[model samples]
Target: MKTISQVSIFIENTKGRLANVCGLLGDNNINIKALTIAETPEFGILRVVLNDTEKAKKVLKENGFIAKIAPVVAVEVSDTPGGLAKALKVLADNDINLEYMYGFVEKASEKALMVLKFDNVEKAIDILQKNNVSIVDDKVALGL
Candidate 1:
């Protein structure tokens, strides 16, 4: 199954922390393709898809940030009403549980891209493919 490497950074909920992380990556020539932050009262998990996963992880770790990489599925959904629902319905019917999801529009394509985490990635990929859903590979996800 094809997957994208998502870099997640555990950051403090303090001023300049987000900027610091972004600045660090930018300074190192890492391009962020997609990003989302899930925050609590005390801290946040900064999840991002970057052009260079290993390099970004190394850069963040060397800067004293706690970063981890995980495989995630990126799928192309139609850019229309019910598009997301239709794709999700395929997963639902297959009894696949979704952990979380985020999305962004692809400037070069008419479809929107959804990044999803599933309880069973391999099974989810198989089901999605069997149902004719388009899965984006690492290269496409990173814009490479």
Candidate 2:
């Protein structure tokens, strides 16, 4: 479905909580591809794309962390001004609501990868595809 698996972890807003999660994943040989943190005064949601989603989730859970997998869309846009804007405009025009998004540039390519969460994932993908936007698959997004 051209969707990527993202692991969302519920974490306390305490010192070293972030580091502990990262350390657990790293110690287990799980490589993180991309990540973002949504936080409040009490806690934070750590969203991450990892090379091994299942393994990462298992490791985190075994360590007493709350983690779950969610589907997200990854789009590749030109590494130039307005590239992102043009893609976003397609969604806005089609009445798609963006939940949140994060991006990282490919060091070996002149393209940027955007990880997007939409209220309607399937609809968003269909709309974006019809509009000719490039959607990255799970394998590519995870660097597998």
Candidate 3:
């Protein structure tokens, strides 16, 4: 799959705080392509992949949120069992460490997409291809 910028915003673990951040995006016309929220006892990291990452970053910064952007790979795979395992095995075989990941498929598409954050992207890509693992490209992802 293609590599996209993932913006992680650290927010206070309070009720409505997440809603507020999401509302801001809506108000600014930013569309979230995919999102995941990982929480710790102290705070929550809102990981978002959006249509306009730069604009989203600017908006978050202007609103006083601690945000960081990093590259992540999105891969589309079969929706059935072992799809995730197959992907994971490829990376494991090469000793690539996956920091985190999450994704889903459109109800219409049958194939699921996985957004993976790894330690080394280039190596990960190489390993994936060497193992015949298909990485979804930007064009394919955008349906271009």
Looking at model 2, the pairs that clash are none
- lDDT-better candidate, 1 vs 3: 1
Model 1 agreement with the true structure over 1-144: per-residue lDDT tens digits: 398888999999999999999999999999888789999989999999888999998888898999989999999999899999999999999999999999753432788888999879999999999999999887777778
Per-residue C-alpha lDDT of model 2 across residues 38-127, encoded as one tens digit per residue: 999999999998889888878887889989899999999887999999999999999999999997434224688989998799999999
Each prediction's whole-model lDDT (CA): 0.89, 0.88, 0.82
Assess candidate 1 and give its lDDT. 0.89
Please provide, for model 3 over 58-101, each residue's C-alpha lDDT reduced to its tens digit, 9 standing for 90 to 100: 99999999899998887877889998899898888779999999
Candidate 1: where are CA atoms >4 Å away? 105-108
Query: How good is model 2 by TM-score?
Result: 0.95
Q: Who wins the lDDT comparison?
A: 1
Better candidate by TM-score, 2 or 3: 2
Using all chains and alpha carbons, the TM-scores for the candidates as numbered come to 0.95, 0.95, 0.90
